[model samples]
Target: MAKSKFLAAASHDLRQPMQSLFFVFTALERHVGTDAGQALLERLGQGLGALKDLLDSLLDVSKLDAGAIVPELADVPIGPLIDETAACFAPAAAAKGLRLLRDAACDVAVRSDRTLLGRIIRNLMENAIRYTEAGEVRIRCRPAADGVRVEIADTGIGIPPEHLDRIWEEFHQIGNQERDRSQGLGLGLAIVQRLSRLLGHPVEVHSVPGTGSVFSILLPAASRPLGAETRRTGPAADRAGDASGLGRVALAIDDDAIVLMGLRSMLEDRGYEVLAASSGDEAIAALERSGLTPDIVVTDYRLRNGQVGTDCLLRIQEFLGRKVPGVVLTGETGQDIVSEIVALGFGAAHKPITGAEMRAAIERQMARHAGASASPVPEESRVAEPA
Candidate 1:
């Protein structure tokens, strides 16, 4: 209840400045055409980006509570994840005169959840971009025996050591006095810390008052052989070749005809042979008689007749004999709902969906399922006993 009020108040307060800033920057970009105006517009853009990050962090927190946050762990190339995240903030970093640099050795693939990791780094980078008035933001990575340590070091206003411990706490803030009056302060780091804990990764910070700050994340090592797996391990597959079987019999069960149609279209466009079931009973009947075995299940979180998406996925996976991948795509974003989704350990994507994002989510599910078994599954093998 308190969180609700805080969110409402925060939204109303923050959006006001963000909207005004957007318009002012847009107008300035259109008219001034001068270098000075360009710089000012860039500054406004950074401010706006910071504001957006704060709000996004809030939404993520709410989603986590609602059980909508799901982690689909897969073999992801460490380099691309960092590169993509860094690219997203490059403009903001440049506008602040920060030289953003990244270092990588070989393509190290790790068994980890990509979206959450991306968000974690993004939170730190966004903060680095926001607080640092000068100097560079450098990302350094080195492989550990079992995991890897990735660091985001920024030459900005160094965090006080006492503040470092508190920074990861929910709703904790340090230097955003101005931004706080308008919108928020502590949400981003809190979100980061929460996600890191969920993924079982350790986050560390080192800062000297006048020098700079370095935030490091230690993640489990990627499982990749130095052979064909290396070439294939670079996050290019739907599921590791071993797990591609899951999407072969993909199922979309939703009561909403529009949702069913949309999911069908999405699957068809992505070249997945999709089967639709309108209700839990129908889905059960179809699976009981027919030889249709689902490799992956994608369903709406809410369905008619009080049958939830979680129940449906659980039932079908139980039937499949082999463990299969599942994703729940929904429109609801309350924290409890999101938390339930996350606790189930499926990929959760919010609705009002974009085609690309939907496809990407499916691909991640597939790859994750594949990478779960480093030892290849022979093409003709169903080695496991039937459930």
Candidate 2:
């Protein structure tokens, strides 16, 4: 079967059984206060974690083959991505009595896909922690040649030299151990390999037979502001900013129910009063029926009737008698479509979106209309920082 078809069918079918099992596990765990029962819950959590890893790896392979994966370059603080990844893996390490340290003291920046870069470092970190039964896992960022080099180093039972080259190959695990068997489908490094290649970067690994291993990814210098660091040291707890502003009603449109629910919850949680619609016609009717003026319209780039987001935005703007800020989200939007989006005065965000990237995109909209007021409530007459 085609990888695309495999993914669509498998993800759909997998979710049903997994979600059902998840609920049952949750219910059973809730009723069991004993340590033995708690062990079952812990094991169940690990199983779910493993299942998610498999799904993500499968999707990564498919995306890479289809050439659907690419870098999203933006001005980002160097410390933030490392910090966020460290925070995510800290609990897992703590559970194993392992120390996680982040030496992200470059006080600099790098131009790269922040999300994908984060994922690469994160996979390395998780794999490091998973393989090691003791000591620490550390992430370090430093200035390299013209860009930056990030290292995820773990003091674990290191890989033998014979196995080093083969490890980054697809589904390859270094050692034949019970621990290695349970942690992943051996796709962590494969993801790192695919992402690095796609982004025109390279990841280098150094490991001793029994001491430790260090994996490094290098990239170019950053171009813009390095604001909003989400390290544990920062005061911006949760750091995921709100999407609401100036009474803008963003239309959340997607055919996938899970994506719809997650995005709607995420947007609403960020304070946007979202109008969810699964189809383009429904999205248009939503605007007409609510008798409400939309401040900004956000829709999935693909709609059910094969209508593109540009088409829907055009129709809605025509109905409103003016152009509104539009943001299109997509799973796979080609380069040509991106040019069209920009030409149509819209912005695009590709999935799966991080809280920070989503906020950044929305802020672009806010910044665009910041000082100018609208009728629903005139845009803030106050001055906004220049883009």
Candidate 3:
């Protein structure tokens, strides 16, 4: 428990700056128009991306060591995950004059934690892009005896046979003995190894010193596609198109002032009327005092005094006398919190979220709320009046 608490706090604190940088870059991207300015912005964005990757890798190690991460197994489609991964790494690969390919069997489902599995693949893709100077990075999915084997093959500088075993060690790097920061902190593969073991997925590597390398992970197969309920609320849903936020009110709560401010700025820039608060109680009080109902609620999962975003969502619904759609923004990776968020029927997005992601989630929630029938507030949700 103490370890979990420490890791949670550390993750939150470390992500604060990255979260702020995301918003700052977002705001900057809107104002810059010159080619030179755009180039500078792009470079800064890349730097931010590297920093975020490092921070996430560190957190993953901490969480894994503390036994805080648990897999939320589900039947997830391979096509969508493959497509998303390709889209994400295409820019980086193109920047290096390399081709990114994805050849995965559609309609194939894998029983695994989507987020963790995605992270593993992403790490491989990022590493592939970093080392490859001119060739291509290919992602292929095929059937295995037990399940499916997804391979990330890179035509970059190949690994020496002797160094293959040491590659999984923390902070171990090959070919760049100078400890070049641009090459990454050498934690990506380490995290991937840990995550693969945690999910009971077997990872394999093949490489020749002068040739390239292929990293593969074998995941259990699922009998059928993910259910409608899972599809509707999964994190991947946040990758949809940007919807307009005109006339919609969003109540956002976060303990960090910088994060709260960044979120408000990002939402207001998209035409949302945002109500910002520091905690669940504050949000409820704001709604009560103003006698205003919100279209959706956006909050950080870990708030002050061990208060969670779900509590705020429930309280906000109680205040509004109807069920209100909500989005939970979090930096924590523990499966327990993720399960709770999904069970509570809220859209979840991890922290250091891009502006587009945040907008998509809010818009999706708003659209759902508009289409669904409003349910009456439950008796248990009613607050007791002061005597």
How far in Å is the alpha carbon of 21 misplaced in model 2? 13
Clashing residue pairs found in predicted model 2: 373-378, 373-379, 374-378, 374-379
Top candidate (TM-score): 3
For model 3 the TM-score comes to: 0.80
**What's the best-to-worst order under lDDT?**
3, 2, 1
Question: For each candidate, what TM-score against the reference?
Answer: 0.52, 0.63, 0.80
Give the 10-residue window scoring lowest on summed lDDT in candidate 1: 377-386
Q: What's the count of clashing pairs in each model shown?
A: 25, 4, 0
Runs of candidate 3 with Cα error greater than 4 angstroms are 1-9, 24-45, 74-84, 99-111, 221-242, 302-307, 381-387
Q: Each model's C-alpha lDDT?
A: 0.68, 0.70, 0.81
RMSD (Cα, Å) of candidate 2?
Answer: 8.3
Tens-place lDDT digits, model 1, residues 143-200: 8777888899988888887887887777666766564633346777888877887888
lDDT for each residue of candidate 3 in 10-82, tens digit (9 for 90 to 100): 7767776788788778877768999999999999988888877777777778788778787879888776788
For candidate 1, what is the TM-score?
0.52
